[model samples]
Target: MSAIELEKDGGLWTVTLNRPDKANSLTRAMLEELADIAEAAVDARVLILTGRGRVFSAGADLDEAKAGLALSPVWERLSGAIAALPGLSIAALNGTLAGGAMGMALACDLRIAVPGAKFFYPVMKLGFLPQPSDPARMAALVGPSRAKLILMGGQKIEAPEALQMGLVDRIVEGEALLDTARGIAADTLTAKPEIATGIKRLCQG
Candidate 1:
């Protein structure tokens, strides 16, 4: 199967990160596919982003990253494109989420994290910055100090702590994450499509 799969269900477009053996770490080709999906829209009422097996995304694929960061540019553009999609978008964090992958979650309108899963960004530990937009997005959600602490600390937090820190909008059992995400996406998608995109963009500002 493709590393990333886009499935249309009625009005919902479920984007699954399908690299189970690699913990769903997205690649350059995957980014291209996602970009195409975002640009098309094509009657998607809602978009749910999730992962296969156990991970939403374990950030970059270390091997590919070491091989000169294969899909960095594509992913950067794709992440921004997904953020501005017309459909309601929700992140379904099934397991460990980190790095640029966490940026993907931040781009979503809402995040539903499975309980006990770890949420963190350790870019600072690697002597690099979080994605340019990450701090601002995270800060908007959890406030500045919390964002600084979490991102700078470079330490992982469990679901309960992540909730306390406002990193997760909702928490559910792993088995329930997709259902919760779809319910949220469906509820939000009830709004007029154009209005949904406009309001979401303004709120992001």
Candidate 2:
């Protein structure tokens, strides 16, 4: 099976990390495919990123990381693509988000995670830097010190704390996760494309 899956329903594009057995851990190819999808999502009115199982993503596949995927530029490329999308981008995290996988989630315009989700970025422990935009994006949501707590202190933030800190916009039950994301996207999905994107641009400003 493909490690990544893409589904389109009108102007809503849903991207899923499909490797449940691997905890959705990413490899170089998976990262590249995700980047490609995000880059191509410019016409989408709303884009939702999610995973198939209990873990959103465990970050880089360990064997691939040991082979140098940890520092790959594709990570930055994928996150950048997501950030640059003209439409609303949402990370509907199904479960725990850890290590480099944090980059893509951080780049989304909003993040809503399952109540059981945990957040962490352990670059300090792994001896690697986060993707170029991750620190700034994360700091923008949760503040620099909290960003440091996760990146430098290796702290794992539970869902409620993450919500309080603004890292995640909402904590949703597993079954309701996608429905909630879709509901949030409902307005954008129905609005005129230019109006939706214009508001997004204004908000980014």
Q: Please report how far candidate 2 places residue 24 from its true position, in Å.
A: 0.4
For residue 100, give model 1's deviation from the true position in Å.
1.1
Candidate 2's residue-wise lDDT over 1-205, tens digit each? Answer: 8899999999999999999999999999999999999999988889999999999999999999999999889999999999999999999999999999999999999999999999988887878888889999999998999999999999999999999999999999999999999999999999998899899999999
lDDT of 1 by residue, 25-122 (tens): 87767767877887675467788888888778888788776675633676567668777776777888888898778887887778888886797887
Q: Which stretches of candidate 1 lie over 4 Å from their true place?
A: 198-205
In model 2, which runs have C-alpha deviations exceeding 4 angstroms? none
Per model, state how many residue pairs clash.
0, 0
C-alpha lDDT of all candidate models, in order: 0.79, 0.94
TM-scores of all candidate predictions against the true structure:
0.89, 0.98
RMSD of each: 2.1, 0.7
